[model samples]
Target: MSEKDTETVVHRLSTIRERLDAGMDRREFVRTLASAGYAVGMAQLLGVDDFLETDDGDVPVVTALARDRTDDPFSLEKRTRTVPAEWYAAVEKAFEVNEILASSRVMGYLGSAVVPGDYRSGTASVTIGVTGDSGFIGDLIGTVSDSLGLEIERFEDEEFETFEEFRDGADRSIRQPRLARDAANGTAPGGVTCETDSTMATLGPAMYDPESGSSFFVTAEHAFDDEATVVGEALTLPTETEESFDLGTVRFDHPIADIVAVEPSGRLDPINRIDTSPPSTITGQYTRWGLADLLARGEPLEKVGAMTGHTTGEIQGIDAVTCFTDNFCRHGQIRWGSEMDLIDGDSGSVSYHPDPEDPEESVLVAGFNNARTWWPGQSYVWGVSAYRVNESLGYHF
Candidate 1:
């Protein structure tokens, strides 16, 4: 080879090496390799496909709104308000704490929720529900404070007796649980009462499973079983005509989250709109940060029950873990204050806050209003928070 030819070849190779070192044309090079049937191996090398081989247990995601962020399940970018970055980070930590405490099954632990203080305070704390004594509260706070390197002040809401934390509460006039034979199914969206072959409960908003992409009728898991769940029990909706339509069968019974997923069997489809005079569409769900913002602002939550129609109440607590009826503790529960009427037939109704961006038209689900809790002086409603439902079960509104 001639010296001039060798010099030209060496210079060209050096330029190519520099370009690769600078990550120039990286994507194009990978795509070229992918087209040659080495996509899987190349993807692994790029660390883009490692999740496929990782054996991590079930991971739940907060689903994005259907309007624009359809591809983003986490919806990290779709936040409507400008929350301070520090506050968001702290609230997320609170959520982690709530999850840990619930999963740990600490002694005297009833439930807990992440409670965010004023943004100006730049702080957040978890409010825990303990049944027997106040001794556990100090130990929990001190342990967390020691690890976090900050003074985490904790308070106790001590009540002597145990009250069943029903998310939805209605008129107490009717004591005995009777089946409402009103129009069932083929009529409205969610928020109406649904009759399982035997008992009655409200139907929740439309939710789709990320695994199958199939829509299903949703409700509280306890709604189906008067004693225990049937093999193929289904729920029915009431119409104004007093007739009914079969929506579907109870496909999934999430005992931990206390949620039930029903596969639609009849012609009626589950709609995103809440059942009202003029229906209300569920645009999105409140993120962990979003819930904290509401708690900070002392915003009110609203819901429509078959018995109560529509009612509004303030957020008393968030990130609550409740051990009311279930053998296992229910984590990430929301507690609403004030007189929010929820009742027997309202077990599956959803509690929501109006979208501050669009109050008159759309709203975001706060949680499933399952039951109201009261013991003499203390009266507030508790239910599985919407964020918990998504984070734990991966079913988002």
Candidate 2:
């Protein structure tokens, strides 16, 4: 169907749902309609007769990412990964379950993500995070889980700890990205050297602010030792022989996203690749589908932190809402790598997966590598997914 036709179908269904919601709970109303076999009938009405003939259990794996137009600075090289239509359809349903749980925000809910099963299984599960009482939340989630054919694994009292202890836990031990670099390695693009106290963190890909329609550099916001003291401070890139060049000035800093946006200081323009041998070009951030596909494939992500240099590791969890770090919670977090894989200076680096089709120097950003789950029984890194940054701040990379 054309986009216009799809829009019309959506509008009609939405209007019907709005009317149905008058007598029933919004959630219940939709659940009832779906269970009453409206999905197939709705598809027929919308000229999607082909959908009715497909397996009821099937899900479509589709990515929200696309090639860049002139206004989209985050666009990079184009690529695609093929998956079985059945598997894709399964994943699509799992994402729906995840969204419902996320929207409910039931008491003590931490966060949730869609995890795909083995290739042949063609199945996917919704990983739900709940703290305190599992009995209550589980019962509530069980109804939806059963209705949707989703599996729920409860993470008991899973509290996410921010890097507060990691920072306040020790004294400032500054280390530059160049220290890990070879003589042949040129200035890293994503790696930034801040003037605040010569602090270091990995530079993420260049991003565009929709409001301003201008470009800027990005990095982990937690890199600033003291935000109040260092706001608007200049950040630069170190050179081998000549003096370091002015890179940009800090423009914005926020904790939820844990990213810092910088205004270029006129010395150089922002580039999308990292600073490693055969430099990896950051084409774009992964879509929700892409991350789920990686999780299902048991893939490993790599990053080039100013301190840690380059390292690879697997994803442990995704869509987690961490609470131990602050009074509130952080949602849509990706947990991967290990404590040993991340440290103080690696905060701003990105956890990325190499493009299978173009493994030479191209990749998609998995998320930001900001902190480690540094406690017992948990031994992986955690950071805001790249898409979450765009979701929260509307800055797309």
Candidate 3:
């Protein structure tokens, strides 16, 4: 080729390189290369280094937390693993799209959740629930989906129950546990009955506040009356065999998330273990992407409510936003199991899954099971996810 022709070719290649460096979509990059007279295979080869840094053919992500020492509640560490780059990109884009939809609060929007596609498909979709079917609403969602290259599944005319309705139907009939003080460990295991003056709820797994370097006994804030926090109502641990003892006072109350942290004032400190047939130790909690991975793998979450004992159910959705029950929307919620898996007194019980790293003895908390759908057409238990709690309150399990 002549020098001028060669210079022209170099200019085209340079422009393509600049666009690639500017983070162009991989598919768009390939299309641009095709337009520039390059084969799709060659385009992929050229962009391989820009897309993913593959180790054994996968990309790395920090999925969950793990404790350096089992006994040390504060010794938390992040766990990472390489995942398929395509799947990662899909999930990441789905999260972004879901956030946009949530922030916009589209007309007729009730709530929505992200469903990550399988590794082979390399896709993700947002499942949104709305109160009515409207053409404009559909068109708006369609336009957003088209522009972002994401799928959206819409559900219309779904009914939702309020917190008051759930509280009114509370069952106080379940037999309470007789917990023995663990003087040897100097900490209390969760999955037992804890009470405010007016109501009772299941004690959740211990939560660690990294900022304060403090561990707290967490439970559903709605279990107490609205004035409980204002009146300095004490939290009590009731035993079947012995007199009930004061566990602590409410340290922090989050009404919207329906969670509260109790400052331990008694001898027993909150530990990371749950009371089960073979006790399950909470090693850490899952991240949003980690929960999505579980959903894609068809994994079930297990919880030990004070009333229901031990029950397991499949995860329905992740990174969900729910606005039906309250005046404001609650984001980063997980919908799982079924309504039967949770009951009135089951509030504050934690939904968890066995740790992927050590499934036999340790587990990772998915979220707090504070409420379940009481309306028809939907049968899943819903609550604030562990990732949301960590992000909002700076607490981790």
Candidate 4:
């Protein structure tokens, strides 16, 4: 049938249904339509002879089926190993990173749990979209494990269109790419060194705000020593604090992202602009990077953590879940590429993407550096997404 004829047929059927609903008698419906000559017109339009066929063989095959099941002759149940809290944290981190990286691949695209695998024997497996390099993936796995004090036993890598793609078998071959080192490594630029002293021996990285006149760093609940004096020597100290850690306003500590904020005593000039911006476009109108902004794969970014100094690298691949070791799983929130290696002390640092036109706006934080690549000669960075970070802490970017 022609397109126009098909439209007419659908429209006529719809009109008939309406008329019947309005109380048109079944016997009189076709008769009344014939009196109006609508039926003849429809028949002509549809090629009248096409409706005269009486071949049962042309009928579609519709079959009745029944559910089939069998009772188990012997009792049997599936078993799974319980992962520790730290291992679970790693798995979650792996999941988050893969999701975000995949989301960044497409415009206005947000990635969800792509590959969520079950825990077996001693490991959890996860897969994310393919970025530029695969070595970075290894780096992320190692980094997550070290942060949680766990190890990743087996690492399974896969490229997926969606989470279900990973679940289903596809005929595509997976490849591992080598990553390059960042341009900025082991070189310290001459700049103002801002520091804060804490009475606690184990203070995590502190965040600073030059614009809002606020500077804050987080430390563990037990960072405070007995005397409540800055545990380490003061360097560019903010000021004197009678207490070791801030207790009244806000305190955050956990196996993940562990640390409490130490409010700055004096006014702090928000340090704006990191030399990471690309040179183009208008200024001021540039967008800012925060926990809320989306991160792209293969994009080179920098991190200034408490442990690792100014380092840079490209973002690798991201996936929903990654096994730290056989027993430990780390979920990825945000995964990026980098060769500017990280260590244990680099927990809290700001990761900023360099945009030439939007230096101030580009200076955003990657919450804190969680882990590094497991094997040597490889480097990667993993952290909490800006969205998740803000949601949990109720902090504005």
Per-residue lDDT of model 2, residues 248-352, tens digit only: 788887767777788887656676777778777766678766787787788988887767678888877666566546556677788787877887677777888
Clashing pairs in 2: 58-89, 59-88, 59-89, 59-90, 60-88, 60-89, 61-88, 162-325, 190-203, 221-258
Higher-ranked by TM-score: 2 or 3: 3
Please report how far candidate 2 places residue 222 from its true position, in Å. Answer: 1.5
Tens digits of lDDT, candidate 4, 45-156: 2222123232322222111111111121111122222333322333444443443334223221122232222222112234432333333334433432332222222222
Cand. 3 Cα-lDDT: 0.76
After superposition, candidate 1 runs with Cα above 4 Å error: 1-66, 69-77, 89-93, 132-136, 146-187, 226-228
Clashes of each: 28, 10, 1, 58
The RMSD (Cα, Å) of candidate 3 is 9.4
Q: Write the per-residue lDDT of candidate 3 for residues 1-397, one digit (tens) a residue.
A: 2345534544665677788889898779778878987544333233343353333456787878778898877788888876787676666656755665576555666778888777777677777766654344344444324423433435544344455765676555646443534335556677888888887789987889999999898889888887635325578887655657677888888888898889999666888889987899999999887897888778999999888788999988899998777678999999999988988778899999999778998999999998887666688999999989989889999
Stretches of candidate 2 above 4 Å error?
Answer: 1-60, 64-82, 104-107, 147-163, 170-176, 179-188, 192-198, 225-231
Cα misplacement distance, residue 366 of candidate 2 (Å): 1.8
In candidate 4, where is summed lDDT lowest over 10 consecutive residues? Answer: 279-288
Instruction: Sort the predicted structures by TM-score, highest score first.
Output: 3, 2, 1, 4
Residue 222, candidate 2: alpha-carbon lDDT: 65
What lDDT does the true structure give each of the candidates? 0.64, 0.63, 0.76, 0.34
| Model 2, CA-based lDDT | 0.63
- Taking all chains together, each candidate's TM-score versus the true structure is 0.70, 0.73, 0.80, 0.37
